[model samples]
Target: MSRFTIPVCHVDDIDHESSKGFEIGDLNFFAVKRDGIITLFQNNCPHLGVNLEFQQDQFLDADNFYIMCSTHGALFQPEDGKCVYGPCQGQSLISVDFEVIEQQIHIAEAATAIA
Candidate 1:
């Protein structure tokens, strides 16, 4: 098993109250920044296991209050990825643990290097 720390982007890259998706190697993820807090989550919807974006970097709801699922219209909280409304109510998005070093978000991952 090998562990790696990958830098995703600068905090300023992700606009406040918005989200942007990124592909780190083979994994897909998205980041949401609200009120100076950054939250990262895998691009998997809890209900149908679908990507949670209507379009590019457009993960928030119409009012930009919650994370919305493109397919089913599910809404999730930005801080903790909790599904506040829609089909997957009470369920939550899978959160990716990350660190902010000098204003850059870096995610730590463990993967088996392919031989």
Candidate 2:
């Protein structure tokens, strides 16, 4: 597997119920904070590769633990980007490696190529 690091957000910039999403290189990344941990996921919904941004950063459910794809109501866990509902079953959002330093997000070269 190609390993890449993305500098995403600051340690103090995110909290539960809130998230930061952005495009790295060839892929969309959603950085979410929950239980004091940060997780990253590719923004493409497996159902059709449509960007989760289609709904204007409204990717989280009201509970804020998973990514909700408004395109077809597919819910995904922020920890692993696994699909919990909708057309794509048993599939998951691609997880990307990332790090947070000085409140900036850096996408590793390999990660950027995917975006």
- Candidate 2 weakest ten by summed lDDT: 1-10
| Candidate 2 residue lDDT tens string, 20-73 | 777755767777777877777777889988877545556787777668887788
Model 1: per-residue Cα lDDT over 1-114, one tens digit each: 213377789999999888999887667889998898889888889899988898999899988889999998988999999998999999998888777778778777541111
Q: List TM-scores for all candidates, in order.
A: 0.89, 0.80
Clashes of 2: 9
**Model 2, TM vs. native:** 0.80
Runs off by more than 4 Å, candidate 1: 1-4, 111-115
Best by lDDT: 1
| C-alpha lDDT of all candidate models, in order | 0.84, 0.73
